[model samples]
Target: MSVPILKQGEILIASIQSALSDRELVELRDELADRVGRLRSRGVVIDVTALDVLDSFATRTIRGIAYTAKLRGAKTVVVGIQPEVAFAMVQLGLSLDGIATALDLEEGMLLLQRWPK
Candidate 1:
């Protein structure tokens, strides 16, 4: 997996590419956590449009990613969940409660733009 960061002022969109598998998710959790730690946080948008699935491990990783980003002083928003991936993620019993989610990148960017730096 690859995490490509796109910066626009106080916004940082981390576009994740490739499948988010169990082992890969672990690596991402650590790597993304470190990346978040190093950033002068603003807001984070995880663009998972390129990913094909969202299993339990992947869901956990995302939650980890969000928490880690928050620790770095950034609000994390997950975006671009495909229909199938959404269904899978929901089936994993992951709650969106306090977490933010967007159907597409455009909406994600808009929301991220509104977040406080």
Candidate 2:
């Protein structure tokens, strides 16, 4: 599976770096909705540590992603933003304002698992 999903007890772990077309992302979101069905409680901790830069399109995709995750009864926590990139995003005003971010993956997952209901 190009988008490999990991099972960790009740949580689903995914490290996403897919450079998909907008249409493809929409399709992926639909598939993700199906995958997350029937879960009592769940969350996603996305490690975007490898992506050096984020443009408008990517940022929009992430926003849509958070929305999709919410629809599937899950929350999304993003981690691993390089300082330089953060600066760039800040200058571009692309900082993920409402989305959660963390210093590292460990902290991000902790925050996601402990998210308020």
Candidate 3:
């Protein structure tokens, strides 16, 4: 299923409520990038709290989204990465690198707000 993306003020929040295949993940990346520009958003928050598994492809796609948003003059925060998922990502050598992340959606929003305009 397609992820639900919501707009709150100048921020775009995409919350993943279920598991998604690689295609869906890629689609999300593309759609978020498009919305960032079209909406002239100042930040993008992707909530993956419901996802229990995060493979390399998913990690890469999320990082790509962050980069794309940055290029569009908007910051991106990936929140809700469970401890198990983070451990698995580390075991697989997957990393978010330059992307900012938080424990949950609320913190993610705060992080975005603190970002320099």
TM-score, every prediction: 0.82, 0.78, 0.97
Report the number of clashing residue pairs per model: 0, 0, 0
TM-score, candidate 3, is: 0.97
Give the least accurate 10-residue stretch of model 2, judged by summed lDDT: 1-10
> Model 2: residues >4 Å from true position, as ranges?
17-28, 38-41
Q: Which of the numbered candidates is closest to the native, going by highest lDDT?
A: 3
Write down the worst ten-residue block by lDDT for model 1. 32-41
List, residue by residue over 1-117, the lDDT tens digit for candidate 3: 399999999999999999999999999999999999999999999999999999988998999999999999899999999999999999999999889999999999999888888
Q: Which residue pairs clash within candidate 3?
A: none
lDDT of 2 by residue, 9-115 (tens): 55665565654565655565565566667554377666667677767776777777767787778887777877887888888888677788888878987887787
Steric clash pairs (candidate 1): none
lDDT of 3: 0.94
Task: Tell me each candidate's RMSD, in Å, in order.
Answer: 2.1, 2.5, 0.9
Number of the top-ranking candidate, with TM-score as the measure: 3
lDDT of 1 by residue, 35-102 (tens): 66666657778888998877766777788878877777778888988898788767878655577999
**What ordering of candidates by lDDT runs from best to worst?**
3, 1, 2
Please list the residue runs of candidate 3 whose C-alpha ends up more than 4 Å from where it truly belongs after superposition: none
